[model samples]
Target: MPIFIDGHNMRGISPTDLEKIVNSPKDNFGITHLEVFYNESEDKLYCVLDAPDEESVWKHHESFGLKCEFITSVKQIKTAKDLKEEKFQILGEFASQLSHDLRNPLSIIKNSVDMMSIKYKDKLNADIFENFAKMDRSVIRMNMLISDVLNYARTQSLILEKYSISEIIQASLEGIKIPDGIKLVIPEHDFSLKCDGTKLQVVFYNLITNAIQSIGENNSGEIHILCMKKDDIIQIDVQNSGPPIPDEVLPKIFEPLFTTKDHGTGLGLPSCKNIIEQHHGIIRVKNNPTTFTILLPKDVEKLSSITV
Candidate 1:
């Protein structure tokens, strides 16, 4: 069986409409729909189908009044598990490519806006200046969302190495602006662990950034980070002085695409979860003082030697 993948620009199409069209009879098109990749954010769909030829795949979609942008034959290396893994990789690649493409135009717009702001600030009225500021903020938010999506999709196959807790925390804090009213307290005890330092830095970065944002503007707060080791396990806790998450929303905090922040992409905590689990660890959150705790194994060297 030959597997063919085709992409369609499905702008403004509903899920029900897509389902009905895909399930409709082929009418001698000689193709079987295997799976669909729909991205609501981009209004695009990629369908994998089993077909006798590329024409059959084209005719199949055309019969349903849909036009496929492109179609290509793909090789199957293994059975169901391999197909699933390949599908995930394909999705990640698509997301990464789309994000990269979008950044180019966005970068141009950002530069134009910056130049205009600098060149016209004296001539622009307060209202125009405010509007420009708003647009810049929106562009920044969009960039952040794209970054989070890319990170969430590609958070796999980590390169592990030895790192000190203090070093990881310091690296994570780099480039992040901390509020003057907020105080970060880190434990003086230094501990070493064998893990993916880069990915772990992202984990701590998300937690620390979330803590800072939770405190909001003009609020004095303290973030206390502590690390401990007992036997073969090491536990790290990040406690922040901020309002507790709503009881109902607590359970869904780590769920993908779930968020409470107005401009959040909702992938931060989910990415954190993926990174932590990829390291064979567990993360938990509690509310009395708003703490996020991560437990990582001390003996990662042994686990790293075993083939997955």
Candidate 2:
């Protein structure tokens, strides 16, 4: 059996003593190799413990000598991008299976409902019909979200292709679900840049969606996009009207796993950064008291180095 051990989170054991416990026989039981995962801050180590059984696990954990919070696994156990990718492949396979399996049944229900409405419109109550229709819509949304998840996973998987900047922005607007009050204004201009078009679109969509989500329900706002060129460089600006992101948060926005929204994955902006860099361009965010602007600069020199 595979057992995970938290080396530092155990209570009632000194560091030296804990070493002795792990080194010697644990509770006079036959224990195989133990897996240890740990992170330390301010001289205290946060740890996660995985063991075979409740009895043996608890007994061994108590021997660590520190009052530790035992958990099955950590939320994110990565120190490098490569390790994260490996874990992503493992988990994403499971999600792909689940999404595929769910879609089959959902499609059947949708088909059945579509057929029934025509045959029995008079008998089916409006509320019941609405519920069925809503279910179909919800399932479709879930399918799209799952596809988004797959695209997200595959994007980080080191794939690259050539794409145009103009098409990407158009696709982004189409893919994004904007709130009623927020409007997106796209400019007409000749702006040409190269990138992984699909992933770049995701970045645009994420940024634009964030703009829409930032406005309060009662507040109205607008997002303006423009493509401009000066000499050899092309600039794409996505500006949104909303409360400015605080100064403190601005610096951290590009950092992976940093988010201002609840239930957000925190990958959107960083992913955008990565996509733009991959395509020989640089993406930046700027904000004023009531507006946020994302700038993408086209430069072969900087773009090549950052992507590598």
Candidate 3:
């Protein structure tokens, strides 16, 4: 068994009520609640549990109708003292190191796949070639997962630059291949803002990719991206003609490591949220057409000065 620490926003739940729930001997997921630390002021709960794996931890929490902000496997339990900031710092460092370590091997696998593709272009049969293509897709997906982890873990300062909304959306779309039966529409109007163009591009890319995935392959869908400037804030909406997000899953969609997809790393939306907040902006989602809206400050320089 491994030790894990999971976090949850307590909402209005009191410590006594939480204790009562945890005291129940419900080992459905083979998870044992060992210790819990509650921050009354912050209304955040940290639970130390003995579980079979991270998935079991998630199931255990889900069984209790609890949404976890994050669930991380820890090697050892340090202290029971209240150290919220330090706890997050430790988790961030662990994620950064883990991602960095995995990239080297991933690169080797990717390069080997490329070489094989070139060398066996003429010799391989159709089935073998298809398998090789699958392998290449897997490598690409793994690389994407690694990038998401690194982006979420590392806290790098923004490189503020002037860029038009149209330009950013265009650059983001260049990397993605829109599947057949899917149509993408971009806003005719453009707005300029001073922000981290690279990070912003990642936000748009994730949103657009999610929209495409939601539409699926067989369905004829349209992805409409709309932009507008209101007062000192600029709003961007990425809407898709896909099934609405389930009511049960909507609230936890932005939480880290929360996903309904089989192969999803569950860090994409969280990373987007982090980047938007870093720019003094907010990212939110709504159903009834499946729209993701982002509101960012029009003048980052002024916002930065005021915050300082």
Q: Indicate which candidate wins on TM-score.
A: 3
Model 3 scores a TM of 0.60
Q: Could you tell which candidate, 1 or 2, scores higher by TM-score?
A: 1
Model 1 TM-score? 0.56
lDDT of 1 by residue, 1-308 (tens): 68898787887566777997667764457765567888778778988777788888877777667778888888752689787767867877887788878988988888898889999989999999977777776675556556556667863477878899899999777625578899999977878988888778778878998999998757899999999987667889999999998899999999766888897767889888877777778899999899999988765655432121
- Order of all candidates by lDDT, from best down to worst? 3, 1, 2
Q: List clashing residue pairs in candidate 3.
A: none
TM-score ranking from best to worst?
Answer: 3, 1, 2
RMSD of each: 13.0, 11.2, 15.1
C-alpha positional error of residue 65 in candidate 1 after TM-score superposition, expressed in Å: 36
Tell me how far the alpha carbon of residue 67 in candidate 3 is from the true structure, in angstroms, after superposition.
Answer: 42
Q: Which candidate wins on lDDT?
A: 3
Candidate 3 regions exceeding 4 Å error are 1-91, 101-144, 304-308
Per-residue CA lDDT of model 3 for 203-229, tens digit only, reads 887899899999996678999999998
Off by over 4 Å in 1: 1-93, 99-147, 301-308
Which is the winner by TM-score between candidate 2 and candidate 3?
Answer: 3
Off by over 4 Å in 2: 1-166, 289-308
Tens-digit lDDT track of model 2 for 1-308: 44443434434446786466547553344455443333445344443334455466556655544444544433444568878767867766776677667878877876786787768889989998877666655654555455445554443443444456667777766545566787778767856554456566676777677777776545788888777776556677777788888899989987756887787766667656655655556677677633434344454544444220
